[model samples]
Target chain A: NAGVTQTPKFRILKIGQSMTLQCAQDMNHNYMYWYRQDPGMGLKLIYYSVGAGITDKGEVPNGYNVSRSTTEDFPLRLELAAPSQTSVYFCASSYSGQFSYNEQFFGPGTRLTVL
Target chain B: AQTVTQSQPEMSVQEAETVTLSCTYDTSENNYYLFWYKQPPSRQMILVIRQEAYKQQNATENRFSVNFQKAAKSFSLKISDSQLGDTAMYFCAFMTRHTPLVFGKGTRLSVIA
Candidate 1:
């Protein structure tokens, strides 16, 4: 299994610009998530989906949006990007949601810089 | 809200030696899961080991073992006979049924030969 994969290993966006971070997993997981990690800080959740076409806001979802069109893909959209959004983004997936002992599989992460 | 803390910002150990990374968490739920993830320069998050809350026996995977204290709310990773390949940033994470995983700031561990 290829596990989880992310596109655009690195990117730089201008202030007020918009972009999407692509994430895909072949593990056939039902739960998918997007998280951002700032320098020297732990990762904060951005958004997640329980299954296809079911997305919800996470702890730090103010500047971001997500869509889960299929079980294999969950993309994060940043609208009007700000300097505060400069961070490494990670995508993860699990076989099931809470109450199960499934471990999350994380992608290599996309490094984004906002100028 | 659940929180995980890794007090040690950095640590180093000689090759073939043993090192322990400390972690503590706060949560009201009794049944949950704890995980240790390693991120190397490659930036991929790798699962090192995991522990289930209700299980009394500690979890071990090859050279990695965890000392889980349910009462103290402490979970520590012990790397025995460490190798240079083990150098990475290790994060302690917590998750309950139906909730996303919460991660600690992480501890950078360097294995020197």
Candidate 2:
């Protein structure tokens, strides 16, 4: 089974360009998270969703928005991408009921470069 | 605020030998979880191992084991008989139920043949 999948493995955008990072999972997990990794830095949470139709702000959610309309899809939108928003984005999912929050499966990651 | 720290930015080990990567954290909560995640060149995050704060015993997964020192707030991962595939960036992370996870900068490991 494909655990977590993120589309647009690589992208380049302008200073004011807008784009969406798509994520999907077939595991039917209730918890999904969006994290970004900068050069030589750890992954920082951008947003999270406890379940379908419910999304919440994370530590670094300034330029991103997420919607979990279905159990399998979570899309992150960047209204006006900035240079600072350029980083490698990852989508992770977990089954928290039976497993701990640390047990998460991550996607391959989307590399975005903002010029 | 919870924070995770991995002092070593990079490490190297000889094949078939054992190596340890250190991780320390600070938190006020009594109950939480600690994890070690491996990221290869592909950049896909994989769970290496996990330990619960409430559990005193260390967590082990085959050749991978963790030394969990709750009082010192230190968790270190030890790999036995290291293989070439063990070379990757390892990240230490912490999280509590309903709370976001805190991750360290990460340690890049290289196993030489």
Candidate 3:
């Protein structure tokens, strides 16, 4: 299984541009998340979905949107890319059930640079 | 809201030695989960270990273990017999049931040869 995979490992966009970062997981996890890691900082949650057709905002959700139409794919859309929006984006998934703890599995990450 | 703190911004230890990284969290909730994730130069976030707030017994995985103090709200990671591969930016995170993780700034650990 590929676990969690993110597309366009690297990308550069000009200010005011728009793009989508694709994320897919083969683990069949019920929970998917998007996090952005800034330089010398920890990953900040951008968006999360408990299951298909259900989504919620996390700590940093501005300028980004996410939709979970299926169990394996979660794509993050940046409507207007800005320098402040540039960072390393990570996609993570975890199984949710009767258990209290959900261990998150992360992707390799997509490095985006908006000039 | 919960907050995690990693006081040590940077730390180093010689190969084969043991080093402990500290993490403290603030949450009124009595039940939750804590995690320590290692991010190497490659930038992949790898889960090092996890601890349940209700479990008094610490969790261990090979050379990586956690000392979870529920009362103090402190969760420290101890890496024994450190290897060069242990070098990475370690992050401490917290979460309630079914909630997203709240992460600390991170502590950069270097394993010297």
Candidate with the greatest DockQ versus the true structure:
1
Model 3 scores what on Cα lDDT?
0.93
Q: Which stretches of model 2 miss by more than 4 angstroms?
A: A97-99
- The residue-by-residue lDDT of candidate 2 on A1-115, one tens digit each, is 9889999999999999999999999998898999999999999999998899999998999988899999899999999989999899999898775236537888999999999
Q: Would you estimate the TM-scores of all the predictions?
A: 0.97, 0.97, 0.97
lDDT of 2 by residue, B28-78 (tens): 888899999999998988899999999999999999999999999999999
Candidates in order have lDDT scores of 0.93, 0.92, 0.93
The local lDDT score (0 to 100) that residue A17 gets in candidate 2 is 91
Task: Give the true-contact fraction for every prediction, in order.
Answer: 0.71, 0.67, 0.64
Q: Score the docking of each candidate (DockQ).
A: 0.72, 0.63, 0.65
lDDT tens readout by residue for model 1, A11-72: 99999999999999998999999999999888889998999999988889999989998999
Error of model 1, residue A51, in angstroms: 0.2
Tell how far residue B21 is off in model 2, in angstroms.
0.5
Q: Which candidate do you rate higher for DockQ, 1 or 2?
A: 1
**Per-residue lDDT value at B3 in model 1:** 90
lDDT of 1 at B83: 97
lDDT of 3 by residue, A1-115 (tens): 9899999899999999999999999998998999999999999999988899999998899999999999999999999999999899999999976335778999999999999
C-alpha root-mean-square deviation, each candidate? 1.0, 1.4, 1.1
